[model samples]
Target: MIPAAHAPTPARRLTVEQVLTGRLVQPLFQPIVDLTTGMVVGLEALARGPAGTVLEFPDRLFAAAIDAGCLGALDLLCSERSLECAIAATTPPPLLFTNAEPAVLDQPLSPHLIELVGGGLPFRQVVEFTERALSAVPGSMLRIAGQTQRWGNGLALDDVGVDPMSLAFLPLVEPEVIKLDMSLLRDPDGDHTRSVCAVVRAEADRTGALVVAEGIETPGDLDTARLLGAQWGQGWLFGRPAGIEQRHRYDASAADLLRPARPGFHERSERAYDCAVDAATPSVATRAEVVAALSRLRDVVAAHDTAVVVMSSADTGLPGVALSLAELASSGRPVIVLDQPATTEFVVAAIAPGRGCAVGLRTSNVLELVTVDDLPTVAVMARALLNRHR
Candidate 1:
């Protein structure tokens, strides 16, 4: 356990509690302007804490929330407050952009939040998330991505070019707004910049999604934003963040609703249990086929260091199955080859958080295989099995 002296101070802890329970944080809106007409298209609501405290700034505010183990609560509180403020504005903007923490994507929200989703905000709400937690919390992220679509809210990937995972999971995220990291525009001549631009352009071309360049403080930065294919932009060049109640609200044409979250996820319909991309009747696999599938599973175990395996008891008799399981176990992954043969006989491997998995079910035949892929379904199935045994 951590020492008391090392813990957050009494005053700091009290500040976090006061901020969350009392909803004392302030919401500041920064306009997202259209580059062509220089018109306000949307407003991104940023949260600030109470005055004269360490929590007044966001960096310290969120860090304090994280230390208190109430980051999720703070996130929900901020979102709720932001939504309420946007709707209460004299003239509601067309789009309201708000931040969402990646780790909170899967947790249940309060009834107030659910009701808010049902009622819909004054404007089409766009929730922004960073790819920083994509690998750390993928199961929740993927489910929320699909859920956000079902909720009729737009999704934005912020600080996209700062990490490789951003580009790697771009397809999975399928965001409507790509908020390029500020650094990309500040120093745009690097090889990495070209790569990011190419990918962003290709994605925009394919999806017809709008690009928003962040931190465009100067005319030069505005030019850089245009060169990067940004149609919408946010920075001091447009306007500083001002509160809704403040008299600094600008008048611009109401922008249309941003694109809805794209389809291709199965969880939106199936919810918690069924996560299959396609539910096809299981088919039998011959000895050669079973061996080949096991070989692939072995490779998956090798590649994904944290992947866990749940093998069918029947598959234990297959050629080299014992050796493969031994190798997987020696690699220190939590592997289980069931001893009892139920109606299903399959070899399943899943990485925690559902980043990747290999799933193949089996039956009375050598294997009652349905499919194999890196879909989140395998992760869901593996988790269900793990729970049942526990």
Candidate 2:
């Protein structure tokens, strides 16, 4: 006979049976912003227990669920809640990042869950994989790597730069985004951390993947992230987790969030001028013009050290440049050609074609100027110049 005061409290274990019965798990959103633009690019879905429950912490809840062999059910529930909440909410379209375990990737995603998410949400929805946790599962990591690409879902490698395992996975998986751990940015000078970050940046550039530096606590950390070429940044420096209503009310524009604390007179003037310019000239250049200019410039630069090609526009901006044969023969420095009139203080150096075409010896270093319709001309000139120089 046990006394009433000494009655035993049963162990509160969340089992698979209980989870399968549709125990609701609410998802909270934390914003991920572009540091340069200051716009909320996406929201990371965080799991939470139902209202008025003792189990509140997502970490604890998830761990318990895993131990009870209810991970699949828990994962499905979280996904369903996140998709439902996102579609039902009034917030603007943003990329939704959901945490996924490696094991879950091999299993077929629930049709109900897919239907909810696929109804309106775009495939830009990112599935963030925990590097350390994924490594532990057998054949799960490879399965996830294959499925993410096949499903056309964006893959994100989270907690990178801290685990050596991430180094191998990064090149193999080639995720859409790589999230650098906050610890690496905390003390950038710490043993090989800077080097590791450099390697990560290079890999990201090569793969055309965006870099997100996480755990930015101070302005210094933000600066470090920017220096390391992180396009997007997340941390306490931005905003913490808040309700959708609260976040919606808060302004997330670049001008609002990135306003200088104490701007100088010149800075203020520049901002005003920039705003006016942006408003006045919205469609500056067409994509075609931009691509043509870049292609011509790349070819010209490859040929000589001081080549020049002018655009056929009214303004006649410096559209292309390269090194001249004489300049290359003398010095290795590449020279840029300017189109605008020389100021009183500065003189524009001229490039004159050599006389008597001695074949390879004097194949006219000056390449053909590229026009809007002259992409082939630029390529031909580039090849000729390279052959002569070589």
Candidate 3:
């Protein structure tokens, strides 16, 4: 029998008192370097909780904050801590990249922003609005965008290609900076994500805005971002997040540390995609009804390729949104997400093709374009296209 994957240890939850006390949330900085000059142009502040705590990690930290109904409070604290840290730095970079959620934006400008306006800030400030939330409320975002701009702070649309709604609001927000989502670089052979990156570059050029590529974890990703017209990048390859005291201590030549891509990475990636298509036995059903069939469908796919599984839209976020993205990244098997017409296109657009992902095409709201009348035919076509590309 195949060994089961180890389950993660449960995180120790953080109480609202700890959050309000400002004793648990610690702000760490990650450098954003200029691709052409290899100089650190800015630092993005990331939040972490005290060591050995459940909230020590960022995803868990924010998740707990959300659960406790203190998301806005946490955001404000992060902003305050980030600026305080930057001010404490002996020679902080000229740009400080911080974040403000939609909830925080709907209210008056963050007090940290007001503090910057009081003449102590020695550099330009950037306030990033992650598009995942902004996409749902365009009107509130527009108002906040205007409010930030009026405060003399640069605006950034974070995770540009990850959410389809970001695309629709791009022209409307006209942000001074657009951050290309790192998911775009995950699949070496995925043409769609690359095409979207190119489109983002073209749009940035047209608007006279700079494009910052987030998550440049590998040398290949760095090179790809440069070729795709990214002027700036942030990720572990440059430096891991650190306190202000150690922020400037990273290796200036960290880009040189990018190991050569393994000889068969591309071939293996393509083969994985081909296997997913060949393994799937498609079914016809509505989004709501698909949940009941997921177990059987997962078994069918696993019988052919044990790594793959089928998931319904409802299954998504039953845990957390980040968990879905993590599944997309880790599962060697293709995760075919079944959803209604409105979400199918967005999910498909967000996924990298070579990472074992394919959206079951929907016609109207009921039937799949590829799996309606036959399943084998769709598999055959998918295999043919994938093999041809290979």
Candidate 4:
């Protein structure tokens, strides 16, 4: 429809062959932090071309690779280089997140992608699958996810909500991390965005997965993400992607997820239980019933010198629970998670990741576990077990 002279030209960049032969692809790391404590939880490895080149940015680099029918090769190069760079980085963190195209995952690896990742690398790896890749080869995604998990690595669903197919693929892949697309939060008032977050929150709650908000550029973006149930976040607002020399610094001690409670924490947990508390359950079929049960149970626990607070889980999912638990646990508070007997497996998986002096109990079996004649005995035993672990 247009003249030959007016035809659109593709951007000039390194050819796929050139990039592979020249090794022009470099890995840049970006910190994904726990917003509540400003702790650097993980670093996502991003691919960048040589400075001053058309492919300097990753989008441009991948666009060229897609046009040249060499996207797989580029993805492989990026993965390998990311591992190399991460290993060489000064004081590498515990988790190194990397990206992989679906096609690359489908192909048989010479050295094997897992080998490159697990071969004496000290850090746990998270392989993020792009939206396009998830949409195209869901079967491969599931296979790769299982393979990675088997190796003790993590799997992330990248750019969630960018494609309609992502939702369909989610249950099948069942990734450990979900990176929400930034566009969803670009406009805070968008009903569609809020609805998407609500859905993600529920899914994460049901699956016990972590939520990471991507593309946070401003304070508002971070705030909205926090409100929408994302405990971990990544964006330029924290720090731009950079080489190891420019890696973002964080106060690792600020996060107390792995910290042990002090010796006298039992009295503190009992004190916290006595204060005002809130409760929430998003998955429960009847909200009123759960609230009433928690209310009565709170009274019983309080009688034994243990304060109880029941935070609502209606809006935020497990992340909401985790964030709440982190705050409570950091202050030496003990949390008791009560769930229906049938849902014990799901409840355990979801709440196990939270940082707190906590115990999970099935509602119907509570009496069986402890003598029903002495309800106060339950609280005493809980506090004793928590203290023993501490």
RMSD of each: 7.8, 18.4, 16.5, 14.9
- What ranges in model 2 sit over 4 Å off? 1-20, 118-123, 248-390
Off by over 4 Å in 3: 1-14, 110-113, 118-120, 247-390
Better of 1 and 3 by lDDT: 1
Q: Which regions of candidate 1 are displaced past 4 Å?
A: 1-14, 245-257, 261-390
The candidate, 1 or 2, that scores higher on lDDT is: 1
> Model 1, residue 84: what's the lDDT?
83
Residue 354 accuracy (lDDT) in model 1? 29
Tell me how far the alpha carbon of residue 133 in candidate 2 is from the true structure, in angstroms, after superposition: 4.9
Candidate number with greatest lDDT:
1
Model 1: per-residue lDDT, tens digit, 111-144?
A: 7877887686667778788976454555566566
lDDT of 4 by residue, 148-263 (tens): 76566777888886754455345434567888898877865687577667767876886677899998888989998898788889999888888856655654542233222122
TM-scores vs. true structure, each candidate = 0.71, 0.57, 0.58, 0.59
- Give me the displacement of residue 13 in model 4, in angstroms: 7.0
Local accuracy by lDDT, each model:
0.67, 0.52, 0.56, 0.57
Clashing pairs in 2: 304-323, 305-322, 305-323, 305-324, 306-322, 306-323, 306-324, 307-322
Candidate 2 residue lDDT tens string, 312-390: 1122223232323333223312322222222211111112111000001101233221122222222222222212211
The number of clashing residue pairs in model 1 is: 3
The alpha-carbon deviation from the true structure for residue 194 of candidate 1, after best TM-score superposition, in angstroms, is: 1.5
Number of colliding residue pairs in each model: 3, 8, 2, 11
Which is the leading candidate under TM-score? 1
